[model samples]
Target chain A: MHPAISVIFFTVTSGAGFGLMTMIGLGFPMHNGIVAAFLSYLLGGGLAVAGLLSSTFHLGHPERAWRALSQWRSSWLSREGVIAIITLLLFAVYALIWMFTGQRIAPLGWAVAAGSLLTVYATSMIYAQLKTVPNWHSKLTPFCYLAFSIASGLLLAGMIGKATLILGLPTPTIIVIALGIAWIIKSVWWRRADTIGFSQTGSNTGTATGLGHLGKVRLLEKPHSGENYLTHEMVHQIGRKHALKLRAIAYILGGIIPVIMCTFALFITPVFFLLIAAISMIIGLFAERWLFFAEAKHAVSLYY
Target chain B: MTLLPAQTNKKLGLVIDLDVCVGCHACVVNCKEWNTGGYGAPLGDVDAYGDNPSGAWLNRIHTFEVTPDDAPAQIVHFPKSCLHCEDAPCVTVCPTGASYKRSEDGIVLVDESMCIGCSLCAWACPYGAREMDPVENVMKKCTLCVDRIYNDNIPEIDRTPACVRTCPANARHFGDFADPNSNVSTMTRERGGYDLMPEMGTKPVNQYLPPRKKSRPEETTEIAPAFVPKAGEGLLGWLDRALEKLG
Candidate 1:
């Protein structure tokens, strides 16, 4: 939960881009012709590829990233890498076919769309499957990922549509609905934070040291004077005051504000409004993802 | 390949005596020294001899002051390393099949060549056993001295973890948990040894011996003093006075 900027940007941008690609794969109708198709595929593809490249900045050996795809049978991370590659490749083919034939292959389009969405799910599972991070371990984690991806995708598509005057209120209405779903999932996830073993009682200092029989065990001294890898990476914590403020920001920007803006966009067809709404939601989702990391308390912190 | 074996032949692990550990950090030091030169990755040291120093160490010693309601405050030294769990999440979560638990001896290991250093295994591990070496850019962890214990060139008595061999207080013991007659197994059975975070379902092979209860004050009243001063022991001139006069 260190909220590394690279990871934050990667998750947010890639998620939105994949969502946009999913929409494209679904053959979203465009009144403004190929611009919608071109913009969605190119922008979405660029964001995803850029996000992926950015993620490798923190790796100790970025060259070995291809090896990560080998363990997909056991690791969600591996699955994510493989699925993401497949999705991106499928999107490329899907785009090429669209460009050359000027005809939509419904089955191939759906496959591309499904692959993109599955990649997002795999990404979410990378965190969701971790029992050590209770805030992310629940079923709600994937639900949030799916909801946010689609919401961001729909909103981005809706913005492109409104900007080009390609489509009508139906896109905005769908964006509004997706935003609401994301809002509900996030609300419940945040609320259940306390109930879902976040307190680390199961693996506290007392239990960790096998000294719980004595009494309350408090840290008398850390193992070292300076921050080691464990303290640096696993013990990233946010203060309560800052966390509360961030939570409010996430709700407003990621959910409520976008809902209101998209609702207005449904009435007023100004390109600026829809565009700004999409941008704000992107920024808002970035905040939300940062909190998703910052708020998760690793089980290892119990020893500290 | 990351899937754990249905059963391991030998659950070889460490058994630590918390009651007797003096917290000297000999185990930590020896672990680093041996592993760095042996099969393990070079334990990197950063900012050594500077205002701040930190590095990757497979084992660490933490100290705690505890005062039970009826007992006097006591300082307990806690030595922590990888427990090599039966359900090693770190191994299972490794995306490159780099982290794995050995079925023959139940020791968890990492193949640095295959490791992408994504650090997902570190997050999956509840014990915080793994350390990312900034120098190597890969995960490093306690291998239970796999190279030492199985090496035929080593003396039979020295065929144990570096930490166990180096414990000044003799608080660390290493043996196969599967062998009922093994020294570690007997000690664990007799001392009521227990696992750390059993609820996590890791089923760690390593065990910790709880602090034994001390006798009440009345019971040891007649015991002789550890040292009895001879005549004229209370003189002002102690060993320091002699050194000062020479100076």
Candidate 2:
């Protein structure tokens, strides 16, 4: 996997947006202009749209993107697109009521929140459903996505809610818990990724050639004298040292830093500190998302 | 719509004999030549005829050296392409329904017009069957020569896939596997043909015939007569002339 920057940004930023929507919508009673104008519209909606648009950059035919939504009955990618549009529409309606009427429609707000969460789940399933790439095909994948979404969303809300809402030990405690849970889930995911791979599907060269009965199978020569689409795309062999270094960066920046910052916030209670925690966490998650794609081994690589 | 049919009327597929394969890339070249003009035409290439050349190809041949415990090392020539699986994840995962398996012939195909070329189908396929045309930015794979097989203009004998027709060693066989009496079916039964990656449960229509067991050396072996040195030739005499040439 090349881990295209467009896709990485799309996943992390859009996930944060949907997570923000879920939190703000769920807590609609705090219907200040800050929550409605800044949190919902500026932060959540802007990131979501920008991320969605960013995803199209890597497409071969961005013009044909509309056709993707038609296959919702089967494709997770299609489902994600549809859910995202619907969630965004719902948020638009909820935003209007909040801004104009100066009142919160509790039901509409909750619906937007649920739809946003579902959109994020659909995004998670885009990778989770791929059995060919066993690393992403697990229950932990969605759990990781959901946890990260909420954690990022909470920090976003925490960054803005100082004037309107109470800032104390409780919010930092919640962030610490979310950070702990997210990293724990990510660790378990890495552990399980090793156990399940292309070998589990019996797609080795011996089985590939159907010559295991004859002897051990090894590549005498590659099919092409030079690289082709399959070799270049599927056979991405990241060095162990680079992957380990990236993993450490993700854990330290994404997981440990946030926890430390939140713990520090317990005594200081500074908005600037929470803002820095949010930025650090996003950077950490950016690293994590990059590793997610870089480390994934496609079963097709077995043939190459 | 992605739900697979209970049964395809004809499981049209290829049976490759590993024993007969000489590791020549005739099938690979023939497929590229025919498909470049037949359908998915122009099989686009970038940096072609340059320092590096890369392009989309429907079929490829892989050569492997295998060494069994207590046995001699054997060279296996394996040709691979789309299996057109009964449970093709590529088709199911295509968001635009561009990737499809025919209910009539069991041949999986891609509709380039409808394809957004997200490469999701290629990701779902375990065989490395699909390739993206960088120029066209669309996914491509073996179509089982749909146009040639059904065409009325071509001669009946030549109405098979270009790969099957061009195999110099006659290793590639094409027919309907659904018909028990078909050549492909009978050959599979007699030769113990097996599916590739059965653990994935895609239920590939194509089957590979494993290499035949080698026969042991006879106990009573004929000995060759010893060579006699030429009357005028000697080791010192040969070195004298050869050394002069080297100088």
Determine the TM-score of chain B of model 1: 0.87
| DockQ, all candidates in order | 0.58, 0.58
> Candidate 2 at A76: error in angstroms?
0.9
Error of 1 at A160 (Å): 2.0
Tell me how far the alpha carbon of residue B110 in candidate 1 is from the true structure, in angstroms, after superposition. Answer: 0.8
Estimated TM-score for each candidate: 0.91, 0.91
What lDDT does each candidate get?
Answer: 0.83, 0.83
The list of candidate 2 runs beyond 4 A from truth reads A28-31, A34-39, A162-169, A239-241, B218-247
- As a whole number from 0 to 100, the lDDT of residue A129 in candidate 2 is 90
- Residues A142-260, model 2: lDDT tens digits: 99999999888877766665433334347777777878888899999988886776655666766666777677788888899998887677776652338878889999988888888
